[model samples]
Target chain A: MGQTNPLRSARLGSRATDQFYEDLRQGAREGKPVCWILGALITTPMVTSLGIPWVFADALAAHLAARHQQKRPEEVAEEKGYLRETCSYTRIHMGCTLLSEEDRSKVLDWQVPNPDFVIITDGCCSEWVEWGDDVRKRFKVPIFTLHVPFLWNDKDRDEATNYVVGQLKEMNTFLEDTTRRKQDWIKLAEIINMGRQAQDMRAAGQQLCRNIPAPATIFDWATALGAVFNSWGKPQSVEIYKSMKQEMEERVARKEGAVVGEKYRLAWDGMIVWPEFGPLSKKLASRGANVVTSAYMWGFFPTLMDPTDPLKSIAWNMVDVWANRNLDWQINHVAQLCEDYKVDGLICHAHYTCRALCGQQLELMDAVSRRLDIPAIFIEADVGDESFYSEAQVDTRLQALLEMIDAKRKRRA
Target chain B: MKAVAGVDIGSLTAKTVLLDLQGQLLSYSIVAAGMVNRKAARKCLTQAIRKARLRTSDIGSIVSTGYGRSLVKFGDRNITEISCHARGAHWLMPHVRMVIDIGGQDSKVISVDSEGRVANFAMNDKCAAGTGRFLEVMSQALAVDLAAMGTLSLTSTNPAQVSSLCTVFAESEIISLAARGCPTVDIVAGLHEAIGRRVVSMVKGVGIHPPVMMSGGVAKNQGVVKVLSQLLKTDILVPPEPQIVGALGAAIFALEE
Candidate 1:
């Protein structure tokens, strides 16, 4: 947080976020019809263009709960008889809508706005289907769900693209009926182009990390890349990426890295512990070890899309999202990142309750280490839940890993 | 000779080893790790110093290891038990390539390089099963001395099976086994087997390099060692004083500096 990235200016960072939320709250207060959009398949630009406000329930709930030291939204879901084993992101997002009025009033109480409608996509996690149902029940809003099948093999790529394209057409019709406005193809293509530009800018910024004494840390990527998820199709999101890319290029030219000494370059392959981000980053900085790349920060940049074909482009992008792919794809993708970032070691966080994230991680770690000939450390931590984290446990484990890296580097020298 | 000390404040026990500049063992002390880890660490180190007929100032450097390592405020540095165990086990048995450390709160399998550094390692998740806590709880349920249960379990004609991996559930299973009038010896044998099986699975994940050795307090259990060796198809080596391995590793590290 201490002067890591110049891209994170007051306007593009916290102030912009505050204003965005303030606009949403104003929308809700004015009885504007709010549409709830699932993460990973965010259609913010589509809804924004229609003069409709969209809500990302999980992001709002997670940020508020962690910042205000209130009961995590996941706890609320558990109270409503959702099993603790449910994905934390989905549970917390669903829990935000389920919070009783009185209970919501006591906490940071950022209520999930009463939705005019909710949209669910065939997102990476299987839990979104159930999350959409919960949103429907709690808010009593009509729900639109999209089904996008897995796209791993090249053989079925065309079929998958067509299927998603068809769904997008149906979604367009649904929007027209709901808002009584015809779909604007030209405007949509422009938005898609902006989103594509933002993706390229962000990727270029991340590529800069490959340089020695990385211009940005993994935490910086996590923070700067977040807007891509929530607001990517907008001009503001594109501007954020533009500023970030410029700042990173300047840092590289001036020879500045995230950590002071920047001795050990590392890559992380898991979600950051959002609640403990400050403490964890500080600890790493204190030891002169910085995470230059993170697989989680690699946004689903739809590979090589034709901007003229908006629906097909969106479909292609959805399938390319990191979380939606098979383990082999993930391993190879992360291996490329490790090589690109010039990583000395890899740290894989096996999240406590995240089945998708934890699946085949041991095998992934083994394969990556073998391929890259670098040491990998597998640590157990809960990304969203602070209750599962222990400072003593993490500190000892990390100290040992850093020592191992140090020993390996010295041996190499 | 300059003296150095390694203090390991684990979940259940605090162990300290005093070593001379040549890395020769000077004296050692072990004490119950009570609630106050700092107190336990101080108590063990002081006892170790007295036994060696040296004053506190005689100790040049003190390195701490284990869960409570950070609580040793006087420590010159702290390292994890994973690295310490690998170093200590490799130091004691140079040919040893793997270290299975089953401590009070956690159990870990460490693969060590030829130069006695951590190559790779795997540890049990955030659970109490397959750890010293599991053995302690089972010994209590069986109403046997924690030290003697291992020997008594070896004499069992039929080892009862413990199906639960959770320590809490395993205790209940042990309780029900006793209620069913099952022989305490057999139940204890089965409990050891359960822990052995769990540890062996973890070892297999990190991969078993020979010769394998057992460290931590759990290594003292003959029943666990016998079952684990049979399961792994490899002889599990235990040091002369198995519980002091982590502290010994720390002392070796202190010696190097």
Candidate 2:
């Protein structure tokens, strides 16, 4: 059984997403209100049920960067005294807001829909706070921050759960005041149920990459993230994952991999350099080494939450963000991913200026290698800034890593 | 009578080496790398072949490494400098557990296992701070020859501190020091110390295990080597011609092939 590549599904999913953006843009233009939601905080089912169009600012930044137009906006942000060391995504978000409404019309390729207000989460990466502040200052937009607490094992689950529930109720009041629309409890329940099904199916698709000669690569998982986030509660999102999971299952039966001549399985940790994704993935695959898993790409797996109690479910999901976790938790999560994938090696990308991600990478690399008996390599580069990456240097490190893996295998044999 | 050849096309220079079946280096050449890497590679290879009194057809295998490896269309295969450097250092001194290579455009520290396989490695940021280009720029600023700066720096009693690891910022700092009539030798010593400090951290980052050897064009600078050895607190080994180690390793790979 030949595996069905999600190429068709990806195209359809992207088309649907594009249509959603266009619809939001048109609505915003006609004075129909919209909210700007951070993609990482997208409890899409709940937000959609609020009867307001919402755009994920990070997705729009990803969109512009994918189109190769991210640098100018970042430069614009930096010129305004935002530290260059800040997350490029945050800079890009600020840059999008800095564009004059008239200037934005010229580059209709990808624009953050005009926002009435911005809703985001606190207690995640501290960068979100700076990003939220910049938006509030520059765009004169009001920000509603859902403060999720960091859960230590010492704390009771109910404490965190009840706190998030309270915040969700506050969010309901904010939306009602901003949009002049009342909350519909019945509609919210249906959205939450759809979201639950969609999450389970997507998780199933992601888990299938663990098979030897994995059915799908990390790139596929990354590509499907937009659909998973944006199309949550839509039957189409569920259908996409259903087909993707079926294809992966067929590949598993055939012992097929996403790349030909699969010689080594690896997992990637840290944010991928978006600009180099195509070239880098091709280079890895050409060497018969495929990235079978990544903690970054598969974040936000569905946690059990009651569909009837939508606010509690959304609150619980918000607290589960990987970025908010302690270093020990992160290390264990990555170690578990390594064991789950049975990876031969780990590629720890030390992205430039990403204090949150790169701060602990040195420890993570050494720990994973020593604990798991898996060799790991550190690749230093910036995710959005092309100037920070040295292609030859990256190639040297990757080749050496692959050769080390080969040596380890030969030693075993 | 077959011989193997290795070509290393670095950012600043292209080098080539010819070796016999017994792994003895027969001949080698190092030349300035111009705008075109393919042309420079061909030039170095032809010169090295002629120096050995051998025809191109006499070479049985050809392997390439370094930044311009892909541009060598005639080569049989291209390998990365990390693997090549580790092999070369291991060939020279089998006990070398760490290799620090400071090239024209980049600096790196590679950790090697007992069998000469790369265990782990770390490279400098995408800037010319602890690299040959930094020295070249500073030498120009000081009105001193690149080769003589190293020897001159050894004479300094008290070196002026050059703190910035950034190439551009350090240049501005050097100009102001020069304006203050600071001795060229002292400033040059400071430059070496700055580079040594930067490279020492990188070595430690990869978990500094010694019997460490240094390679690449910058290895010829005794000022840097002396300061680096002092900073690392270990004797650093350098080959007769530091620039050709990558090429030598490429030849070693060709012989095995």
Candidate 3:
């Protein structure tokens, strides 16, 4: 199904103008606080700074929101319908939601829109957001926006750091000048410091686990410590980290039964479905495959990390740990998920234009296949660049893969 | 009467150079690679042979370099661009110590020893942001061809500031500038300055000394070369045909081997 522009005005020309006026009046009369549910990836920070109480939905929020949009069983048949509509990992989490409608509605309404002062800060492609103009209508506040580029090349670490710091400084100046209000630079500094600390703790944990026996338990402990440090002195962050850990543990313990007729459990790694996640998920389900786990979903686990020994962690993680641990962890984490999920195969989507993500696809696929003895099909696709993909070619290749999986299963049986 | 042929098939163009046994260039030919490596190599070879007024068998040995070096199936040997470039620069100016070859997809700073051998080298090939591709993309954004950029940039009395070093960000930066009614010349000069800064930093990272030679397609961009020379606080030597340096080096290598 084609996406009707979410922000498009219904009528063209003067009709749109009239509709906009009508919207403004309705918004004024209702006097509801403008609420913005910010996607929590990279975009969260910038949005949150705009005084929007960003909806703190992890991968689950995006998934649930996508499912809510797709209101029919047939809609679930096409992978592109749900999975390709949003980020796939988010869609999957949202699809797995056991929350009651009432509770979900409350969660959705968590933003207090009155006086329109809720901001969300999350990481996404650069930092950007889409919100209703109701807040602007009600409060007449300008939406301040700041976008960070998503490229990460540590080889150019000095240059990248200088660039980022410069952008941040410029953004700070813009915020102060535009709003005629001084930002809490202290808060920004604290968050940055905490982020760096958390990064360090996670690094240390990664190194400690590498040469040790009982690696998983050690890593988990290290991760939990890192999460605690990452969420340091922030009640909301602490609460979210606690919930995430509890949820992860519960999910692991419950070991949900395989869907009735599901034949293969697959794990996806890296970015997915910027615009077509809904359709992609439905397509996969039609093939009787379940993506039980993904790295993107699990990768956010470190966001919760906080450490007692931040300096120590940073030293170990940033200096002593393997230079590519950040990427390597994602790959290894996905491999671990495949094993834990008892997945039959893995599909590693190497998106074009995302050199950082795509760069590791070949190496990850090779490593995963060698370690697990599972057939890994590495597919190249763009997250949003539709021009690079051929649906027919992909479908043909997928069908052949499913057949190969079936033959392998039958032989095992 | 002996002559050697060198072919450097880069990502965007193919260059072939003919050198007499005395290491003097007899002739050279450069043409677009046209997205087909094999055909581009053949075209380059044919053009060079015709230009040199000699048949294919007249060449004693053929050496290939650049990204598409292996595509030259007719070549006697394939040498890495780094080695070939060093040799080529050495042949051009025996006193030259460092050779900076900035190609379309990759850039390198080659530190040469006294004997024209690669002593220490640094390369940035994983990203196109720091190469001639960045300039090409900027040219399109600025509505100019590769050739016109240098001359147009020279007209800028006060170049517009370009902050982003990343290719995508830099393009968007240019777009935003154009949207704000910034002049084309200023933007072009800004781009040249940015690229020059990037190249200078790369060279500085590997420790650049005097008598640095700049080669590759980007060497044709006088704007970048001017800014680069200013940044380095020294003169940069550009051969008569800068793009053919890699091929010239390869041919020199063929003779030595």
Candidate 4:
């Protein structure tokens, strides 16, 4: 099996480049082929589109190796190094995507004709690796390179224009140097227009979906898709929101049971399926406590967003409503859920890693508690990092709360 | 003399105090935050006014502080707990240059100037490690009322070391200690020690100054205070009803207004 080694070292006189090449050479000599080191900027959607069979890093390496075949090995290596240094997610994904001998052989041996042009597009955050790979796979063309820079909303338009112009100038320089072609000013202008068109399409799509209710689960997926596909069109957020509301209504209606033992209904809001969710639910069940509803699972409903016009939809949904836009709408939506469920208490889990989600937990808890007179408990936990959570501590708190609720019920009885 | 009322509705409790034009605390009341914060605030205010035997109309101004200050319907002014705690602690202890408040869901260290204003402060509102809530969880795990944790911790000979700083993990760690036949008192003492260490790190992060007054509900726990004092190598002062310091500060603000 002729294994194509994706790892390349160009003799560019830099010690770092030399060392990287030497490492690859050593691996090759040892019969361990290194293929596909993905940068963190590649997203799941990009991966799916690229028809890449391997993980993130491996797919990235393979994509780069195939796309930048005409370029010297050192240049590709430098790009990979630059990518790893900047993005942690890219680094993690790249590490995950590195391929073994059998996998490397499969990718290297696969034959596809090279295309006339390759266009690379990136959103604000790094997931551009997947998009680049997708274009490479589909067109079989070397990307001439396309980059979309992200800017803060408060950024001055004049400053942004200057920055974009500077980027285009740099790309022109790279094209001249790489292809040994003279600066074609007219073609350059056309290329800029194309980039703007792509950006506009995505922005338009996001705007159309701006009104979509954010479903907690499908947010990342919808946002990524919108950024790649729908920059110009109106976003599909409103439709998604309506669909989600319908689904939730049906689910709630179906779950509605006869008022049997206790009239008190408690709901846990915030991220769940965390370390203590199993134990917490079990404890509540043992006490004949019915957790009538939760925001954690329901928060991710897909109907809250439509990805038909993904870019505009994502941009609209990702907007921080509390500090920037009034979250009165979301507050009312949550309040309605509580009322419809006939909830008596709410447990607000303020997860540690999520700054945006955690910021509003206390305020929301206070508001809902006041509006409904339902006691709310704010349980703190780290969703992925279990080292921070104390199970015994949480259980004890929950037990005390249960006793308090029981006492309240008995007094009423 | 102008009379004013300041309400500091904290995460764990609601506090209200009455102040005269001269900045003297005429009367004060503390109440647990039940299901309804509005009712709790009204009740605390009524109780404090009753203690002074003054009419609500006599109050020239009303100021609110703490996390729950925004919810106070009758308050004329709302101030951050950070500023309120600094002002209140300065009034209570004139020489107090540093103030460490461990509330229900958050912890703060306020540095005051000679004139008694917030010079610089550091706060950890993101985690439960150094807050009063951590102790509450541990107390419940030990099957002890929150009030008894301080006294009970004093009796433990060999305190079990709680390694986890996270509240959820600390609970499991306690259960594991229990399984390993560790005494409940030792575990309780360990929890206090862990919390003290966390708080000490935070205070040290901000560079601690002497004459530090430990206020808030956690200040009531002598074990935590003792360990915190030892860790920082400084004497910690706890006022009667330390939880009301923010309210006291708000009342003082009302007096100045």
lDDT (C-alpha) at residue A341 in model 3: 60
TM-score for every candidate vs. truth? 0.94, 0.94, 0.43, 0.47
Off by over 4 Å in 3: A1-413, B165-167
- Tens digit per residue, CA lDDT, model 2, A150-259: 76642555788799889888888888888888888888888777778877887787778878888888777666666665677777777777877888888889887887
Q: Write the per-residue lDDT of candidate 1 for residues B156-179, one digit (tens) a residue.
A: 989999988798899899899999
The top-ranked prediction according to lDDT is 2
- DockQ (C-alpha based) per candidate is 0.67, 0.66, 0.01, 0.03
Per-residue lDDT of A37 in model 2: 75
lDDT-sorted candidate list, best first: 2, 1, 3, 4
What lDDT does each candidate get? 0.79, 0.80, 0.57, 0.55
Displacement of residue A1 (Cα, Å) in model 1 is 17
Residue A47 C-alpha lDDT in model 4: 21
lDDT of each residue in A1-413, candidate 4, tens digit only:
11111101101112222233344445445543222322221222222222221223322232333232212222232345634222222322232233334543444322222223333334332344564464456445444343434334434434543544454455445444444456544433333333344344333322222221211111222212222222112123223333334433443344422112223456666654233433554455454455555543333211122334222222332232222223454456567767766665677766654454566666677677668765566566644334446553454334434534543464458
Candidate 1 lDDT, A1-413, residue by residue in tens: 22333235313744455656777778888877888886534455567667677777656644554464335567787898978777666766666666776767655646556788888885676667777887788777787788888867767778987988788778877877876777777777888888888778777777787888888787776565446545667777777777877887887898877776787888898887777777788887777888888877665564654568877878887777777788888889889988888888898888876776788888899999989988888777776676667776677667777888877876789
- Residue pairs clashing in model 2 are none
